[model samples]
Structures are given as structure tokens and as C-alpha cells.
Target: MKMVFRWYGEGNDTVTLQQIKQIPGVEGIVWALHDVPAGEEWPMDKILDYKSKADAHGFHLEVVESVNIHEDIKLGLPSRDKYIENYKKTIEKVAKVGAKVICYNFMPVFDWIRTDLFHRLEDGSTALFYEKAKVDDMDPMELVRKISDNPDFTMPGWEPERLKHLSSLFEAYKNVTEEDLWSNLQYFLEQVIPVAEANDIKLAIHPDDPPWPIFGLPRIMTSQENLRRLLKLVDSPSNGITLCSGSLGANPRNDIVGMVREFADRIPFAHIRNVRVYENGDFIETSHRAADGTVDICGIVQAYHESGFQGYARPDHGRHIWDEQCRAGYGLYDRALGIMYLWGIWDSLERNKQEVGA
Candidate 1:
């Protein structure tokens, strides 16, 4: 596994590239032009600027966390074709900058949702938390306000521009269903996958944040069967999955190891993190240690090692550690710690294989 770190770029992020490069096994940064709105064509000069910065710091800019999908594409609006054309152009621009995998999602409106950004844990560290009952009872606008209350930092999915049209977005999805979402996603893949293949960039779709429908929004990328269906839609190596453990692990039944074994060849990127699920259906993001959470991170690593995974991987959704104030779920201290934990697992697997060979 080639470990990478997610850097939101200079000025936008508290963590610096210098700090990222100091992590023992991290060789690259999973990044994107966060300032650019979804569906707009990315300028070549801007892409190069990011590459130059990473190169200057001795880090590769080969994997992007996302190129946000336009809501028009997900909603299957009449204007989707134009946005898709722009998306294709952006894909070409990304390829030009040597990004091997472009991680994107097809979720409508909000990309990921959490009821609390800093729910205090038993250990005094804060983490991104989901309260099941509260989500069911809370008003949509109230939830949005709670998540975006931090004016100083920008949340990944809750873009201010998008949330500004909260009521309109909810109304627009009134008639859309799960099947509609699947068809729309297929339409997107059909248009974008060929271009991705031609550019030698794999399109890895990140699973829904909680792996479930939220606020009555249809979510399809939530389970193994759904992932299989998605892969078969394009039926190309370029069409792949990001294989996010924390997202899929929210549902205890998801066999992450089985997914690794089954989709090993098609997975080009991974977001490895842990979350402790409560009996009441709540969950809190935790450290990457296997024993600390419900996810079988150790078995997941073994599967990746046995399958000889050569793609990029990163530690996703870290806790707020050492009172380091930064983006919710994206503080540098815990994420750096998570990287070492993942590296420790990978090293043990490699050493065991060598011992067996000897």
C-alpha cells in the first residue's frame, strides 16, 4: 500500500506540506482545488500550481480526494450534459498533472453529514459524531447550521454555496428515488469512465458517508452488492472504488475484508479509519487501531497485503487530538498518528510474507 495524506492546500488548511512529509510512510497528498465550484473546468495553471507546491515539498500530487460531482449530474437535470463536458475537461486537466486516481462521489447536495463536529469522547478527545435519534428528529436547516457553524473552517461536503440553496435542494430531490440515483450514477459513469481510461486515471467513487440515505436523499453506494453493481455498470479497470472503511463500517454487517478480497483489483484508493458504533445506532470516529473500533482494520490490511494492492491509501476522519484546533475530523495530530498505525500493520504483513517465503 502507498500511503498518502490529505492536504486541503496552503492557507485553506492548518496542516502544512512540511508536516505531512515528516510522516514516516506518507509519499503523496490526496488533494483538490477546493475553491473551484463543482462542474467548472479546472484551469491547467492552477493544477500545475498545486503540483509545483507538492514537488517543492518532495511529495507527489497523484491522488485527489475528490473532484466534486455537480448536483446537476446527480439530479439528472437537462443541464447535466454541459456540466459533464466540463467534468471531462477537468479530468483531462487532472491527468495532465499526473494524478493517477480521481476520487469523486455521486451523492446529491451534501457529500457527508454529521450531527456534531466535536462530540466529546470518553477520553476527552473530540471526534465527528452521529446521533441517530437526533438526526431523525432535527430539522434539516438546523442540522446544516450546526455543521456549518464554524465560520473559520470550511466543511468538505457542506459547501456554503450549495447549502445556501438548502430548501431548493430538498425540493428538487422530492421526486427522485434510489433507482433514479442509480440510473443517474450510471449515466455519469458512462460519460466519464471512457475519458478516465484514455487518460490513465482511475475514477474511484467514495461510498456514502454513513453508507445510508440521509434527509430522505437517495444513497446507492452504501453496500457490497451496490458496489458490485456500480463496477459492472462501467466494466472497466478505470471505474473503481475508494474503499472507505469508516463509511462502510458504520453498518456493522459490512464485511470490509470480503470487499477487499473481492474488489482488490478494481480498488485504486482507500480511506482507512475506525469508528466505534453504539447500541443506539450512534457512532464516533476513532483512532486507526483495530482494537479501538468495530472495523477489522487488521484483517482489512491483511487482505490488501495478500492481494498485493499497489494503489494509494490514506487515514480518513481523525479525532481532534492534543487540543489542536482545526477542521472537524481532519486535525493533523490524530491523522499523523493514524498513518503510523496503518504503516505498522502494513509492515507486519510484509515481514510475515518474507518470513513465509524464506
Candidate 2:
């Protein structure tokens, strides 16, 4: 596996590329133009600028976390065609800059949701938490307010400009069902996959944050069967998956090892992280260590090793450790440590295989 680190650009992030390059096995950064709005074409100059920055820091710009899908495209509105064309152009731009994979999502209004940004864990470290009962009964607006109240760093999914119309976005999705979402996603894939193939950039779609519907939004990429269906929709090698462990692991039914074995060839990127699930249906993000959480991170890494996975992977959603005040889940200290943990697993596996062969 090719280890990559998620670096929010120059001033937007506290973790510098210099720090990222110091990580033992990390060779690249998973990035995107955060200031750019959805549906707008990404400028080639801006793409090249990031590429130059990564090159200057001796890292490759090989993966992008997200090129957010426009709500119009997800809603199948008439204006979707325009946005899609712009998306196609953006794909070409990213590919021109040597980015091999473009990770995006098709979730409606909110990309991901969490009840608490800093729920304190038993060990005194804080992490992103999801409270099941609270979410089921809580008002959607109240949840939005809680998530967006943090004015220090911008949350990935909860863009201020977009959430300003939360009521309208909710009303617009009143008639959109699961089937409607699937059809719209298929429509998007049909338009962009060909372009992605031509540009030699794989389009890896991230699964829903919790791998389930939230606030009545229809989430289809939540299970293995759904992923199979999504792959078949485009039926092209360029149309792929991001294979996020934390997202799919939220649903206990998802067999992540089976998914790695089944979709190994199609997966171009991965977000490997662990989460502790409670008996009451609550969950909290944890360190990448296997014993720290419910997810069998060791097994997942073993599957990737056995499969000879050569794709880009990163440690996702780290805990806020050492009193390092940074973005809720994108803190540097824990994630840098997480990368080392993953590298240790990969290194031991490789050494064991060599011993067996010898």
C-alpha cells in the first residue's frame, strides 16, 4: 500500500507538508481546493500550484479527498448538466497535475454528520462522536447548529454557505428517495467516468459517513451489495471506491475484509481508521490501533497485504491528542502516530512473508 497524508493547504491547516514528509512511509498528500465551491470548474493553475507545492516538499500529489458533488447533480435538477460538465473539466485539470485518484461523494446537502465534535473519551482524548438516540430524536437544525458552532476551522461537509439554506435543502429533498439517489448517482457516473478514464484518473466515491441514511437522506453506498451495484452501474475500471473503513464499519453488518478481497482491484484509495461502538448504538472515533476499537483494523490490513494492494491509503479521523487544538478529526499528532502504527503492521507482514519464502 502507498501511504498518503491528508493536508489541508497552506494557511487552512496547522499541519505543514514539512511535518507530513517527516512521517516514515507517507509519500503523498490527499488534497483538494477547499476554497473553491461545488459545481465550479477547478482552475488548472490552482491544480498546478498544489502540485508544485507538493513537489517542493518532496511529496507527490496523487490523491484528492473530495471534489464535492453539487446538490443539483444529486437532486437530478435541470442545472445538473452544467455542473457535471464543470466536474468533467475539473477531473481533467486534476489529472493533468499527476493526481491518479479523485475521491468524491454523492451524498445530499450534508456530506457527513456527527452530534459532537469533541466528545471526551475515557482516556481523556477527544474524538468525533455519534450518539444514536440523540440523532434519532434531535431536531436537524439543532444538530446543524451544534456541528457548525465551531468557527475556528471549517468542517469538511458542513460548508457555511450551503448550510445557510438548511431548511430549503431539507425541503428540496422531501421527495427524493433511495431509488432516486441511485438513479442520480448513475447519471453522474455515466457523464464523468468516461472523462476520468480518458484522463487516467480513477473516480473513487467515498461511502456515506455512517454508512446509513441520516436526516432522511437516502444513502446507497452503505454496504457491499450497494458497492457492487454502483460498480456495475458504470462498468469501467476508472469508476472505483475509496473503501473507507470507519464509514462502512459503523454498520456492523459490513464485512470490510470481504469487501477488500472482492473489490480489491477496483479500490484506488482507502481511509483506514478505527471507531469504538457502544451497546447503546453510539460510536466514537479512536486511534488506528486494533485493540482500541471495534473495527478489526489488523484483519483489514492483512487482507490488503494478501491482496497486494498498491493503492493510496491514509489514516482517517484521528483523535484530538496531546492537547493539540486543531480541526476536530484532522489533527496532526494522533494521525501521524496512526500512520506509524499502520506502517508497523505492513512492515511486519512483509517481513513474515519473506521469512516464510526464505
lDDT of 1 by residue, 53-85 (tens): 999988887898789888989999999999999
lDDT of 2 at 246: 95
- After superposition on all C-alphas, the RMSD of every candidate to the true structure, in Å, is 0.8, 0.9
Error of 2 at 194 (Å): 0.5
Model 2 misplacement above 4 A: none
What digit string (tens of lDDT, one per residue) describes model 2 on residues 1-358?
9999998898889899998888888899999998888889998888888999999988888898789999999999999999999999998888777889999998888887789999999899999999999989998889888987887776777888888888998899999999999999999999999999898999999999888888788889899999999999999999999999999988887899999999999999989999888888888999999999989999999999999999999998899999998888998999999999999999999999999999
State residue 176's C-alpha deviation in candidate 2, in Å. Answer: 0.8
TM-score of each: 0.99, 0.98
TM-score of 2: 0.98
Candidate 1 lands at a TM-score of 0.99
Screening candidate 2 with a backbone cut-off below 3 angstroms (N, C-alpha, C), the clashing residue pairs are: none
Task: Report lDDT per candidate.
Answer: 0.91, 0.91
C-alpha-based local distance difference test score of model 1: 0.91
Error of 1 at 293 (Å): 0.8
